[model samples]
Target: MRILRTWECKIDKEIEKCKQQLNILSGVSTNRTTVLKIINDVKKHKDKALAKYSKLYDKAFLSPKDFRVKDNEIEEAYRKISLPFVKSIQRAITNIWTYQEHIRISKVSPLKTGGIVLDTLYSPLESVGVYVPGGAASYPSTVLMNAIPARAAGVNKIIMTTPPSKDGAIPPERLVAAKEAGIREIYKVGGAQAVAALAFGTETIPKVDKIVGPGNVFVTLAKKEIFGYAGIDMLAGPSEVLIIADDHANPSFVASDLLSQAEHAPGISMLVTFSELLVEQVTSELNRQITKLKRYADTKRCLKKFGVIILAKNIDECVEISNKLAPEHLQIMTQNPRALLCNIKHAGAIFLGSYTPVALGDYIAGPSHVLPTSGTARFSSGLSVNDFLKRSSVITYSRSALKTAYNDLAEISGAEGLDAHTRSVQIRLNSRSGF
Candidate 1:
């Protein structure tokens, strides 16, 4: 792992060599054709598709009746959990709501143009479908991340779907998070089935205006297939973290941060630093600490595949390379984080300083854990309240205003070779005398 001498040349060549694997990140296959077939089948069959996929993938049998969680389950969950945990979830929700509200942009009117008004109308989607990953791990955080944004944007109806267990019961923590976020509708559906049900409504589940949240490969592919049918947050890939550190960065801190994402799965985690000496120290630290960790095998594989100890010549060179990568999460652990912030052009989320790790932002930091991956941050953004809302461009012109701009409109319309568009404007010009 000693990438020295012409280190930049080696790093760039190796990055190109791994481009194919890094492109899709779609677990087993990227067979979009089969995924489309599944999407179309679900669109046509509805609840039948849900049942078939549930059996085929999750090996769980469920019906529409089993979709709804009982009231007693919620009460039981509260009874079983600690009071302090409940309070913490409440506090996190409050902070998330406040931050989103402060950033929410309101419709504005342009006052410069006399008698002509242009505004942007913002309104929430009528309904949203949130998919929370299940099985071995249940993320109440996913529920909060997806639902709170829709609730903050004033989405009228929020429907949630999670995979049912073999007993055909949804997890209580997910249910608690749903209820706390004002999500009234719940369904026990997951994977491609859940995406299908949300995209093309089943007999029981209403079609949602937009679908949001993260899932496995099947779910991600299904979202890709159903995008035009319904709005999606983003085509999420494997969880990723890119740390840009310096010699000042602690080796243990660097190792811990890298392993934090590596523990997510087998294709996450990357570390790039300016100091070659620091990379050696951090790699040794990772080996020392990973042996003591529970998920050593998976972490080791992740580190072997996508995990890298890139050595850059200088801090500016490291920043340049990071912009090219545009990772889902970027951690800047060098001195003067504020000075470097201006250079970070692309990232799903940036964690500044040694104290702010990606782990903290993943849980209680109040921003969002659902982020864009696989270099999508170059074009898209992370999940937020803005994802739940739609904007309509507004235009209003008085007769006087129309008279003033009639010539310009006609000229552009005629130049574009649309006679009807030109005639439409000409008609207004012929009839207008207000000016």
Candidate 2:
């Protein structure tokens, strides 16, 4: 890893390069065009298109009957995994459920003043489609994080989709996790096509009210394109972590935490601190640790390409840089993590102290690991139970209340040249006296 002073002119160039790597554009690209074509093909051919794409992209040929995972398959998955592993998934489910229940949004009671009653009703979505990435590796934790919250929100139907392997089967661990999280309606499909199947519904897959989870560039682009057709969580990019450390921090722990995120292959890991010696120490530690990991080559490429070690003038400067980046995961390993937290304006998840690594949030931590990425934390938030629920405003006005506010309503509507709106209110008021 390269270390540089924050004041250097190269910092701006590096920041721009990072943003470009995020590829946060709606412009024309070969990938975007291909995704668009795939979406259109899926829309037109439906289940047949899904099968064709599965064969072409995933090299897994399947018929419509084989799209949804069978109950027998889930049972077989349970038998394949160890009992202790199943128990661990169950334990994690409890933790996630407990946290989601505490934070679940509640319906507000009617607020009555004079004769007007205003209220809001919160209701769970009837159905939701969760996209769990598969193919190279299984993300069972993602199943727990996304489905548990939806279940807690009282979502009646939760449908899940993942890419099938060359053998045209979902991973056993993923199936086990989905079953433990109370998600039985799972389909063996993935990628942009899976997203399309969820949005538009094939003969085998049922269309859902909302879609959630993380995927690669093509999947993210598919979500962006089909957003209006079906509600979607944020368009997630590659995983990233920014650590704000100090001289008092542990270099080994810092290096380990950074590698934990970098192991995601395309992930970005950064360190910002005032201690020059700590920078050198963490660099050495990262070099020492990177060689022993299974994903050593991929993680090293990620660190070298997207990672950075910044030498700030002071702790305040460290916080300043962190806020500007608005990273998906922010770890504060300073002398006083809490004191610096108030200064952090944007971050998907904040991990305080050296012991609280981003990995905790990724797996067992109460908060959903699905978070905003690529500076989107400045305006968005992590996934939660609220994402599976919809809120509707309720307005009730009695005759007296309508009469009292008639002129104000008319004035506002008339100002906007909306004569029909003004007249609608006036007619109601006029009828109050038995006209």
Candidate 3:
């Protein structure tokens, strides 16, 4: 909604302000207290706490018996949804499953170095919990993105947890997607309570080895809280997109992309471009497009508070600024989008050219849209089959191999004053015939 100079100090402050607004850590003390209480209650009381919060927060009024999604409900879901929607979900499931399988880890052959054999074994997690966020909205895409990868990784069980609508029913779209993704065990619960229920086994909802997906502030905070107890994918914050455009880029396209991100309500949208004329055009287009959105007020507020167009000196400066932010979604709308690829290193996902919008990555694209946010792309990556697999290092040493390294091992253990470690090795060689 405003123009910022690349050299201006206000750039940092403005970005920090919006980040604080978008980050889960920026939540008030009450949120943490609430999340902790819900976690504690769910751990101690189990299904009771789940039911209590389901009634209090989601107003679903589900009981312990109603927590698990029954077969009848899934059958009803098929009846409720349209044929086109089912076909679309089926196609998306195939695409996601194929992509995840392609990138999934494979068996590593043992490395035989003399008498030593070293190998790495990759095994899928026994069970995984997929958290699909719902309160104001339902995310069927989230179901596919989170669950399909686990299935492709050969995980034995994939459980799903999502908030229910006021009518105490999960959305037919989400249910159908879950079925296609091979997630049979689903519970009608969400928010912090849903996360807690997944972390600690309730009477009905079983605990899982790891939890994956995105959610609101409460759910994100709950994931942060239960990280040690139950593995989490990432501490994802609100959605964000950064677009770099040149004068040749279409103003309408740029504005539409920015608006798409802003429609997430608290989403942050930014543009780094050298062309002031394009800025003017995009801003005008934004104003014109703002009136057509269903979520007009929320999107307008997000754009007003968090959106900005930065006037960079050139393409290099644009890339430099983008790397610093490490935005969740980076779109290059320059003449040659791939030309900027080498200079750009930090981004959750990168989309090249004007035709590639962020929504493709969000919904139908093969890659999982569950990406790192809040500058985390510098260190982490998007969710995939890799997250569901655990690796174990296997080592088998022959007698000759152990004897060859015995002296060094003994000396190192001696230096550490661990006599027991040296003795354990020494005992093996004490009565050898050569000795």
lDDT scores in order: 0.80, 0.89, 0.90
Could you tell me which 10 consecutive residues in candidate 1 have the lowest summed lDDT? 1-10
- Model 3, 1-435: lDDT tens digits are 878886775566766665566566774589999999999999999999899998999888788998888999999999999999989988888888888889998897899998999999999999999999875666899999998888888899889999888788988888998998888898899999989988988889888999999988889999999998899999998899999999999999999999999999888899999999999999999999999999999999999988878898888889988888889999999999998999998999999999999999998888999999988898999999999999999998877898898999999999999999998877877757654
Candidate 2, which segments miss by more than 4 Å at Cα?
Answer: 24-28, 432-435
Which of the predicted structures, 1 or 3, would earn the higher lDDT when compared with the native? 3
The sequence of per-residue lDDT tens digits that candidate 2 reaches over residues 1-435 is 667687775666766666666555545488899999999999899999998999998999898899899999998998899999999898899999999999998777789999999999999999999999985678999999999999999999999999999898888999999988888799989899999889998788999889999998899999989998999999898899999999999999999988988899888888999998888898889989999999899899988887878888899988988887889999999888999988899999999998999988988878899999988999999999988888898998888888899889888998999999988887876674654
What is the overall TM-score of model 1 with all chains considered together?
A: 0.93
Ranking by TM-score: 2, 3, 1
Clashing pairs in 2: none
Error of 1 at 62 (Å): 1.3
Clashes of each: 0, 0, 0
**C-alpha-based local distance difference test score of model 1:** 0.80
The parts of candidate 1 lying over 4 Å away from their true place are 1-9, 25-30, 432-435
TM-score preference between candidates 1 and 2, better one: 2
Q: Considering lDDT, where higher is better, how would the candidates rank from best to worst? A: 3, 2, 1
Model 1, position 7: C-alpha lDDT score: 59
Model 3, residue 114: distance off in Å is 1.6
- True-structure lDDT of candidate 3: 0.90
TM per candidate comes to 0.93, 0.97, 0.96
